[model samples]
Target: MALWSGRFEQGVSEGAQRFGASLPVDRAMYAQDIAGSIAHARMLGRQGILDAADVERIEKGLLNIKRQMDEGTFVWDLNDEDIHMAVESQLIRDVGAAGARLHTGRSRNDQVATDTRLYAKELLLSLVDGNDALRKVILTSARTNFGVIMPGYTHLQHAQPVLFSHHLLAYFWMLTRDHVRLVAAWRSADANPLGSAALAGTTYPLDRAYTTELLGFSHPIPNSMDAVSDRDYLLDLLYACSVSMMHLSRLCEEIITWSTTEFGFITLSDAYSTGSSIMPQKKNPDFAELTRGKTGRVYGDLMGLLTTLKSLPLAYDKDLQECKEGAIDAAGTLQDAMACVGGMVATWQVNADAMRAQASRGFTAATDVADYLARRGLPFRDAHEVVGELVLYCERRRKGLEDLTLKELRSFSPLFDDDVLEGLDPEGIARARTTYGGTGHEAVKTQLREAARQLGRDRRQASSLRGRMPNVTGD
Candidate 1:
């Protein structure tokens, strides 16, 4: 029988029962559900809503259920509909009338909301660790290949020479912003919804603050109506995952391009690469390609939930049941993508000579030429024109800026001197950008140190959040 079936004359059809069940999606949150119940039961006892003996019985029964779940001995019944009912029904069976007292002042509306929030908090902490791991891998790569020069592009055309470390650090900063988003999501999920039973204030003298402390929530949600219905925290989480996945996709796109024969800038480790069955010579960056492809699915997860929540009336509804799976799916997708990207980055071999060779080929020194002329008394526009004509001349002659003689360069501008040749050197061009946050080697060294500091701070913050969480075994 369904938990709410006593008031109805007939049982729900098997089809409807299966259709309405959230068991498949929410079973992963059973630990959180149990934790929330234990906290609520203790709060009830403290407020004298339930006696201490009943609270004790409820606590022991909940722990036994958690143990059965951990040991794979808890059998789920589709009739239970959701994780809350499954756990509650088992609690009732184990502790008799004491379990019946557990729901005296609460409703499934607030209970589900509380459980989801707890689960989201736990997942966000894991995500923080995952982001830290990926950031460390990026910092390690930047440090290992600090002075390697690569062509920096705008619209896929080489625009300047930049240190490879500088390029990788750009993603480090992107993910640092992502870490902020994750923390924001965590804060949004930190409020306790347990006392706002069924979208309204409960009749019982519930000690919401007690439950908040017991469950490690920062505070109780101030608005009872909003507590059971609000899913902005879930949206915050999905948005964070979407943005992080997008960043990963961008990096993966570059990895795919760099590993190709035409670019030849990198070679993914054999462990991260796949071989062609028919073409013995082909080594494929399939993992990078897959991560890039998975970005669309993460985007879909966000959109699906947004559409579900768009027009729903306030308070709990059947429609809200659609929210959990998307958030869970997106979280899982990002976690796997982060791990894959970190592994790929950690193991890839940088082809320094090939990178430098390509960096030199595409007139990457044109900007430096323009800068050279600009520094030597010509207006910046005039300097740009001179470099444009020089690039055209080199293109027509099948040559590079470095291939030009001093006399040949002087043909374009009297400003040309033997020193212009030094400016044309790709490494010299890269190291010349000494402005803060520039691609210069010294600037990248500073960036690497700051990145290390930021990563350390984020790891410490995540550790602190983990410490605050109520220690549930096997969570």
Candidate 2:
């Protein structure tokens, strides 16, 4: 029988019961459900709807249920539809009639809404923490590899030589935006929805603000119907997760490519890699590839929730039950992916020599050389054309620009001098980029300092949130 079965004359079939139950998906919200119930009970007592003794009895029963669930002693009967009903039914059995008073001013509509908000808030905070850890790893890697030059590419062909630190910092900024998205998602959930009973306001004199304060929400939701029906917090969270996963997948694609024998740019540590089953010599980057592959799963979760919410009308609906599994799946998949990537990055080895070797080939210095010719009184367009001829001559002779002698360069343009050789070297080309935010070593140092400042601010924000939750520590 269901918890609301008093109105029905017969029980639902066992198969129907199993098919309709949300216990498997909602069980993860048990802690949130208990926390919301406790706040609701205290609000009822404060408003004189429930006696102080009943409040104490309800709190005690909820805590005991939490303990049994924590200790693996609680029986999770399939007859219970979800974690909310399961715990409430247990509370009634334990505390007799006072347990019934726990729901005096609320309905499961707003109650489950409140619980989901709490769950989303906590998950958002966890995601912020993960983003911080990843930011730190990227900033550290960038700082350590600041001077290591790599071929900056367009269309997978060398376009210029860029400092490796600059490349790494680009990803750091992408993740910083992810941290911002998590903050927005967290705020979306920072409101109490407890007093919106079913689709309308409750008749009892419940203080929604008091419950909001007890639950650490910013305020009580203003509209009764909107409060019960809103799953925007979940939508915001899933969207954030989806975008973050996309960014991570892009980084993972780079990792997979950079680690391959073809690129020879990085090596994964054993802790973050797996060996082939039959190959005698193989160290496969399974973790990075998995992060890349799981990105579509997060995308699917986002689309599934959007489809579920698109046509639904008004206040709570059974269709809303379809929302939980996708949000939970997206969050879980993203968290695991972030962890795997963070660990892989923290332990992996950067192949500086290989990166530097690729930096010099494919005319990475052609741009600097053109600029040098243009500076020496050649019209910029004309300088480009003349350098193009020099490159063509070198290609015909199976020679690089660096391989050409001072006399050979003079054949293309009379501007060539013994000093021109100084501008042609890869190291000099990288250093010649003195513009702000260029690939020069000094510019990379400036970028690193700015990155550190941003990372410090994010850490302080995360730490302040940690101070709010004494029960949670170190992710």
- What CA RMSD would candidate 1 show? 1.2
Candidate 1: residue pairs that collide: none
RMSD of each: 1.2, 2.2
Q: Per-residue CA lDDT of candidate 2, range 1-475, in tens?
A: 5668899999988898888899999988888899889888888888888889999999889988988888889998878988889999999999999997787877899988988988888888888988989889888888777688788899989888888888888889899999988888888988888899998887888888888877878888999999998998898999999999999999999999999998999998999888987996999888888998898999998899899999889978999988889988988888888888888888889999999899888988787778888889998899889888888988898888889998888888898778776855666677777788887778878888988999899889877765553121111
Runs of candidate 2 exceeding 4 Å displacement: 467-475
Clashes of 1: 0
Each prediction's whole-model lDDT (CA): 0.92, 0.86
What TM-score does each of the candidates earn? 0.98, 0.96
Superposed Cα deviation of residue 123, candidate 2 (Å): 0.9
lDDT of 1 by residue, 1-475 (tens): 8778899999989899889989999999999999988889888899898999999999889999999999999888777889989999989998999998999899999999999999999889989889999999999999999899999999998988899999999999999999999999999999999989988788889999998998899999999889999999999999999999999999999999999999999999998999999999999999999999999998999999999999889888899999999999999999999999999999999999999988888899888888888989999999999999999999999998889999999999999888887756889998988999999888888889999999999999888898888754335
Most accurate candidate by TM-score:
1
